[model samples]
Target: MDIAIVGGGAAGFMAAITARRTNPSCKVTIFERAQKVLAKVEVTGGGRCNLTNSFAAISDLKQAYPRGYKLMKRLMMTFNHEDAYRWFEEHGVPLVTQDDDCVFPKAQDSHAVIDCLVQQAADLGVMVCCKSRLMDIRSMQDGRLELIFDNGTQRIFHRAIITTGGSPKGNNLQYLARLGHKIVPPIPSLFTFSIRDKAFCNLMGTVVDPVVMTIPGTKFRSKGALLVTHWGMSGPATLKLSSHAARMLAEQDYKSPIAISWTGERSRQEVEENILAMQIANPRKQLATLHPFGLPSRLWVYILSKLGLEAAKPWAEIGRKTFNRMIETLVNDQYTIMGKSAFREEFVTCGGVSLESINSKTLESKVCPNLFFAGEVLDIDAITGGFNLQAAWTTGFIAGSCVAE
Candidate 1:
């Protein structure tokens, strides 16, 4: 049996590996358009290749995905984080989980993961044909599928798995759309908001506790540790907002007002009370020197400057209006986002082949039988950390197990 996997990414590779193991007699081949495979995995988590997360509960894991959460209910139940951990370790890749619950290979490098997957594929007789871009896919008269390649090569496979990752353009998925599937307009997710404010640029590298970030006039909001990047605000919180609000932000052309509360869980009144107490406790202390609310020294300094207050001004000198202004700046600061850029190249998309067109139970296309999908190719994406990779692995594993020889 000739089984063609039309991608060489994490999901495609996992599908290939699964198919080969499930039916060892079947001939499996990965058709990748790139010069090499696992390009995204090689760079995920800054080259550490965060393979999976340590979220033990399905409820916890289910919350991370912005789209396809309902569709993934069965998929996650089938092969979740625990199963992923055991699979890698059982396949000879030592794994480690950090306090943050991100899982990475013990070797502390993406190469370790790429090598492990490649070695396993090679051992299982799965051929990874790089630079073999699929130009078209058509059903044959004999119940087979014909894959036309850019290089003028063609192959007839008894079954096929479409694990092509998220495409930045809708035209890229036109071939699949022609196969009777609906394409959700793809938009960038898990990205950093581009704030043109000079103060934001100057505050690069500022890491703060979980901040409550929200898109004005939308139900989109998230709370997590935020990092001020050279480009813009990134880190877990911002990325989560981006993922969940991808469509809303895109509709606004990426230009929108954002509200952030430095005191993540605290209400504005709570922050105000805390600041008032600090003033009474340390009347002679300089505002910047006091670092109210335990904010980072640099961040506190910036907040003061942003409010047009002198850092050396004593707490006692803070006027009633200025005090209220300080409270607002700390708990209700607003910034206009001009644009966005990929959050490391791990940028995911909330849009893809609509989840309704596929069978969640088998990861197969209801529009076209024998044609399956996994990973970002489907309308499934999650926020930062290792959730995206976990989805890819789970879907790929399911597709691989279900595909016929």
Candidate 2:
């Protein structure tokens, strides 16, 4: 048996390794377009390599993905995050789960993760061909896959697994579409919003408690630790919102009307009452000195300044009208998102080969028998953290395990 895996990322490498393990008679080869294999793995998690999440159960793992949640739930029974973590540790890569539930090599270097996969493939006799860009694939009448590369090279294999990680462009998927499979037009996911607000941008690096960041006129919203970046808003909250609204915001051409509620549903009247009480309690304190509602001191100062309030002014001297304005700014702040920035560490595309066209059990293509799909190549994506990598591991393992059978 011969197996060919395309695009040597996390899923590609995993598929190659598992294919050899399941059936020793099968010869596996990885075709990577780049000069080096596992390039993304070398920089994931800021070089720590978040291999998989530490979800206690497969059911918990499914919730992390927005695109393939239901499908992944069924697939996780065969191979999941726990299995992935164990596989790594069993291969001489010491693992540690951080407070954030992300597993990484104890050395905290992504090269360690990359080296383990490369060396494992070498030991398993899996051939890796870098700079071999797969230009087209055809299902031969003899039940073989014929792959043609850009270098004018061609190979025929009994089975094939496409582990090409997400592409930001839809045209990049034309080769897969040629296989008569539906392509879910690829779009960006796990990105940061580029807000043009000076008050917030000036206070870069300020991380505040979770807030309800909603795209006005849509149901997209997320609440998590939001970091104020010089470019815009980032961190868990913004990244989650981006994944959920990947296509919707793209339709808007990346210019979004962003409305952020620091306090969720705490009515304006409630905020007003809190302000009145604070004024009475700390009459002598400066408005800037009094950081209310648990907002960062720097943020509070900026909000008050943006509201045309004097920092040195005593709370007692503040009038009801000014207090309401300040409350509104803090509770229901708004900004115009002029653009977006790709979050380089684990950036992903939300669209690819339609999941409906895939066989959920073996990851074999219903449209193209003996041809398998894995990782972001399928229309599967998840939010930030380690969910995306988990999907890659899951689909890759299932494809490699079942291709020979």
Q: What's model 1's lDDT at 116? A: 83
Give the top-scoring candidate (lDDT).
1
What residue runs in model 2 are displaced by over 4 Å at the alpha carbon? 56-63, 263-274
Give me candidate 1's TM-score against the actual structure: 0.96
lDDT of 1 by residue, 1-405 (tens): 889999999999899999998999999999899999999999998999888888753355446888888776778788888898999899889999998889999999999889988999999999989988898989877878899999998888899999989888888899989988999998888788888988777889899878999887878888889899877788888888888888888988999999999988898889989889989999998888888667899989888888888989989999999988888888879998889887765877778899889987998888787889999989899977788999999999999999954
CA shift of 19, model 1, Å: 1.0
The residue-by-residue lDDT of candidate 2 on 219-308, one tens digit each, is 887777889999989988899889988888889899988877776557778877888899999999998888877889898888888888
